[model samples]
Target: MKRLADHLQPGARVFVPGLCGEPTLLLRELAQDPERARGVRFVGVQFPGIGSADYLGLHPEAQQTAFFMSPSVRQGLRERRAELLSLDYPGIARHLQQCPPFDLAIGHFSPPDAEGWCSAGVCSDFLPIAWARAKRRVAQLNSSMPRTGSAFRVHLSELDAAIEADIPLTTFSEAAGGSETELRIGRLAAELVRDGDTLQFGIGSVPLALAGSLTSHRRLGLHTGMVSQAARALDEAGALDPDAPITTGVALGNASLYEWAGRHPNIRFADVRSTHDPTGLAALPRFVAINSAVEVDLFGQVNAERNDGALQAGSGGLPVFAQGALRSPGGRLLICMAATAKRGTLSRIVPSLGAQGLCTLPRHMADVFVTEHGVAQVRELGLDDRAEALIAIAAPEHRAGLEEAWRAIRNRL
Candidate 1:
């Protein structure tokens, strides 16, 4: 701990792996004595519920910056104790590529293999890139983190220091079985999927529900940004390709899934450069991309990142998948969401996005819109037809108002 603290000086910036790769023990030790590393900044994205934000709250000199928002860090940003940087999923690798030499890079990794290589395990998102940019690299060799034969491997000799910790890897519980609306949306979205389709399922109740609905499909292939428990289930059910590997940039699931991934030779992890590359994704035959959004306007603009004016999550890999699916030979991009939000009071299918609405996926890039009511194939549709199709999927209570709003905006356009 003394040696770790000694590496940090006032105003030094350190890079910490977020998601399932956060080194809990190392971070806890650093938080214990903030005086030793005053004015130090921790940079990362989507930190799970660790005390990283709490440390920022307690120590005025310490700062935390994130490229994506998680619950804990989002709270800190709201209080003006932290800052947020805007970047997409693939952009994460580019951000690390451009980062000035970092003071230290800390993360969790699997135990060294026979060849003295440690895999980033559940998270291979940007650790390799961060490692190249950091002046020092420290890792917690956790037995719990499953090694998925990721290309993001580092030799044991490369680490400046290694700490052994056997803590359980962080798990994101599945959303309580999707609501009636979500289930209906899932069914609608799943109907678009066919056999031999390579799939990209985003994280949410809707996607999980869609995965459940896909149990009967055959020969499905996975090439996604994040592999969830649902993807494992599909593979277990023999729905996925028997010989082809399930490719993902990150894994976010439970202990059982982690162990399963470790033993499964078909679970192959790659970096975002390969996973989210537009040209590479287009080459996959019959790709199907299903993702949820916070809102979608009549113009087919998808907003997955904001609520009213508040930041919800980052753009993530949705843009990449959407464009990729559109370019695939027989691909379909389904942007799904419940018809309403705020306890079913407000329509998620709006006339136009609110002032702060972010077009995570542009109107032309979208293919299908799914909700509880029905599915709307809006790709290549004109403004009036697109509005009509989208409004038809809105909740019955909000349909009339949405139509009126569209009519007013239609004339203006």
Candidate 2:
């Protein structure tokens, strides 16, 4: 611990790995001796739901800068101890490249192989970029981390310091038995996907349900930002293409999925520059991106980042993937969400996205909108027709109110 603390100087900007790549042993050590990290600025891309650590809480003088907002750092934001970059995955990579170099970078990696090469394990998104930009590098070599293949590899000798720890890796397991509405929306979204389509989705009950609905499809390829436990089911059902490997930036699932990915030849982790790049995705045939949102308006605006005027999450890689899927020759962008919130009291299909809600994707980017009621294909439709299609899929109880609101909004236009 003394040797590791020697690298931490006051006012130094340090990069810490987030998600499944977080070094629990190292972070715990730092928290134990708060004086060591006093006045230090910690930066990383910690996600919501999966990331539980509050880096700003490590010390009274500690500051945190992040690209995403989560409950872990919301207090810091309010206290002015945290700053958000407000960028997507690709934007984050670019910022790390052009910004001032970090004083130190601490990352978790799998044990070196016979060739002395260490895999980035479950997270390869921003660690590689931060590693290159930091003046000094440290590696936490975890024996439990699955040694997945990726272009981002680190030699044990490259790191200035190496700490050996065999702690349990962080895991996020979706709850069993999704809600009835989620299953219905999943079935409708699955109907839009062909047998051989390449898929991109994130972590949620809807995606988990969608994976169950897709077991009968053949030769489905995955080029996604995060690979969940659903990938295993698809593989077991012979739904995924046997020849094509699963390309993702991170593997976030339960311990069983981690054990399955260990030294697995079919999984290839990639950096955000490749995983979230629109041009690369545009070339894939029949690309289908299934995403979710908090709400949508008749104007085709999608708000995935906020709920009731509060920042609940970040606008992750959705916009980038939406662009890619829209440009693909046979691609489809499916936004799946329940027709209403609060047990059908509040309509998610609103007449307009008011100032309280932050629009993650604007009106032009919308394509297929799915709900438990039905599917709304509005990519080629006009403003009036698009509103009609979306209203038809909204919850039946709210249909009358939505139509009345839309008429008033239409007159203004």
Candidate 3:
């Protein structure tokens, strides 16, 4: 640990991996000498295991860079004490292409096998991105990280430093608690799901609740872009089809989900090339892709990103599934969510999206909108027809408001 931190010069920038894959132990040791580490800049999605945002406060010049603003880093970024650099999914990879990179890139890696190459574990996707962009690669080797497959690896000979540690990573957002609305949405989502249907969804209450309800299904498969705690619970309940092609790009969820994924026979962790490949998912029979949306305008445009002026999340895996599900014969692409948020203060079935709303899936591609109220079948509908159907599916409290918006948009009155 001492030797690894020595690589840092004053005002050095360090790239840290996001999610549970953070290098906490290394950061803690460096935090000891507040003066030496104070001026250093940190970069990544969010600080995973780097404890005490207070450590970075030692120096006013200290800042963190993030592709997406996470709640953990939100305060720092908001106050201008830290900087938030917004980049889309593809942009994140492109940002890694810039030269004259960080002083060192740190990551938690699986111990090297007989070949002397260490696996990047859950995030070969991002690790490769960072490695290509980083000036030097330093890894904190841990046995806990599953020795998963990858295209390339960091070798002991090439690494600037290799420290040993058994530190855990952090989660950006915990699972939203299952509510009556979520459960009802889940029940509706389950009706659309059938046997041998390949599933793809992100981490949230909706996915978890839906997965938990699928115990009776058979030959169900998984080729999702991400997995959540509900997916893990389904796996434990013997609902997930283990023998099938269970693929994923990342697992962002609770501790149980992380523990369930570490080299579990059922979970075959793979890269984006295969997992998020639209062509590949389209080929699968009975493929059912479920995504969430922030708001749905009258035109059926799905806003999965942004809320007001702030960026809530990125457009991840939603378009991939939407396109692929359309291509797959007998497949369904469904967007499921509660009818409203803010304690029913506002409707998600909006007359118009907030200024920050980014249309992730266009109206033409969107298939179904399922809420506790009803399922709005708008995939093949015309503009006016779709608005009518969407309004019908909205929660009762919000339907009247949405109808007025629909009427004005259609009649121009």
Candidate 4:
């Protein structure tokens, strides 16, 4: 294979894989020839904490256009060298379909199977769409990548160039034990979940802790956007239904989980259109969507994207799953978070989301709200009653102040 830079041209719009599918070898090669990459534009959806590649820093004139904000792109965003497309998972797929064809699509894939097909492996989110729309396709073939059965695959003949490497896949390890507050919140949230429920959750400390709390449950099913180490624990504990497949867009975990998923018959890696589609999710029985947020107001509105007036993340698949849960029979949308942040000095359950806060999920979409103190079922409650329920679950120290704030807000109404 020729050098990765040889395939690139100035001002090219390159589609790079994100998350665990990131082609480090190709990126390193591109970074090595900074002058050649000038005016190059890198595009993809990078998740925070999972991806940390500064593509814009490769050259002073290099630019990036991404769907999600990450630490790697934050500097470029502030410097006006990067663009953040505020689109949900499904919307992103649509954008890619309608946007101008990319000059090149570079991806990391598992080695060819008996049929000469390479799997997208741990990250199949949107690469397939981009791959189809690109004029040229390049792949970094890694033997270390798990050949997941249900992941998207590309033919060896489809690639314009291929670079072989043996680098380890990126891994994410959640802390073994969470804080006391997280444990309490997890336990409280777990109490709302029942056997035979189909689960959908995002990545975070609370969800990990919730997994630990649900070890005793039985026959739970998973239809989530991202599958993490927590899914392995559920399967091992026999909490997950043996017959149902673990449907997810991506499998993000350590090496052991990857190895397990490679041979596991029940793990299915799907595309975003299927994983995040509301209609498909609503068809599943007892679909329970559990997600965490930065804060929740008495009205049950959620803010998961921003904090302290700064953008921290993207819209993601949360809203889509919430809609599914709401429409599904016997389904529930559980918004789980600690009642306080910043060492208990601030209350997460507030009187209202102020002008600065971005409401990621509106009040009606949240069926239940869980805090360390307790769970508030606010879906059927009116405004006044909803405020009281949320206030009751607030931290003991903040309960009184929250009640006072709610009362003032109520008087204005």
Candidate No. with top TM-score: 2
Q: What lDDT tens digits, residue by residue, belong to model 3 across residues 288-330?
A: 8888888888788898777775667666557777888999998
TM-score of 3: 0.86
lDDT string, candidate 2, 158-264, tens digits: 98998888888888878776999999988889888899999999887899899999999999999999888777778888999989978899888877888776656
Candidate 4 has its poorest 10 consecutive residues by lDDT at 1-10
TM-score per prediction, in order, is 0.94, 0.98, 0.86, 0.97
**Tens digit of lDDT per residue, candidate 1, span 7-102?**
666787888776677776665666686675468787776633422334465466777778766765676676675787788877877877886978
Q: Could you tell me the lDDT of residue 308 within candidate 2? A: 90
Q: Which prediction has more favorable lDDT, 1 or 2? A: 2
- Over the full model, what C-alpha lDDT does candidate 2 score relative to the true structure? 0.88
lDDT of 4: 0.86
Better of 1 and 3 by lDDT: 1
| Steric collisions counted per model | 0, 0, 1, 0
How many clashing residue pairs, candidate 4?
A: 0
Tell me the tens digit of each residue's lDDT in model 4 across 320-411.
99999999999999988888889889888888998768999998786899988898998999998998999999899998898889889889
Candidate 1: C-alpha RMSD after superposition? 2.2
Of candidate 3, the 10-residue stretch with the lowest lDDT total is 46-55
